[model samples]
Target: MNEHAVDILTELRDLVREFVRERDWEKFHTPKNLAVSLSVEAAELLEPFQWLATGENGELSAAKLDHVRHEAADVFIYLIGLADRLDIDLSSAVREKIAMNRAKYPAEKVRGDARKYTDYD
Candidate 1:
């Protein structure tokens, strides 16, 4: 990832820490709570597209898109908080996951296919 992106994440992490500290919410930000909160926010993110056939096409009304944007931010915030509590570097973790996925789903073997890697065997 670019340095700018890493810097932004660091800035966000610090912002979240300050926000939590100011609110005296550190006691409530246990890894389990953050994990559950992350899941809840992620589920909320799907609400805008729950009944839409074209949801997969990225076609959402402006209002629905705005709702999704906020929900996505919530999910992202909780994710950052969770990573912070665990001392995990989000960017590096993402890079490692991408590398692992590339090995599991090689472009030549999985072109235009959406099946799991094990399904091909």
Candidate 2:
């Protein structure tokens, strides 16, 4: 089966809703708690590279890579859950942010360059 065959965010939202309803977890899934959970999961996702020395490539075994994948999925799941709880349309937000970033880093000046937006054009 194809992993990307479905609308993952919508499926995640439904699953979260069912989970919350089953466990009466809505009260505990407040925005504050969700934000904290998201941050913790994000940190977990970063664990594989956390101790890499500067300019050193971090390497991981297959099991470690699997762990990283799971952690990353957890972070995204929690983020979508939080967005559903708050009635936020995450896709729209991402689109708007991309537009904002394009304005900040216009291709005409930044194309093929690795400089920060504040650097000389």
The residue pairs in collision within model 2 are none
| Residue range with the least summed lDDT across 10 consecutive positions in model 2 | 1-10
lDDT of 1 at 100: 100
Worst 10 residues of 1 by lDDT: 50-59
lDDT string, candidate 1, 1-121, tens digits? 9999999999999999999999999999999999999999999999999879877546798889899889999999999999999999999999999999999999999999999899997
70: Cα error in model 2, Å: 0.8
Backbone clash count for every predicted candidate, in the order shown: 0, 0
lDDT of all predictions: 0.96, 0.81
Residues 25-99 of candidate 2: C-alpha lDDT, one tens digit per residue: 888999889999999999887778666564133477677778888998889878988888788977778778899
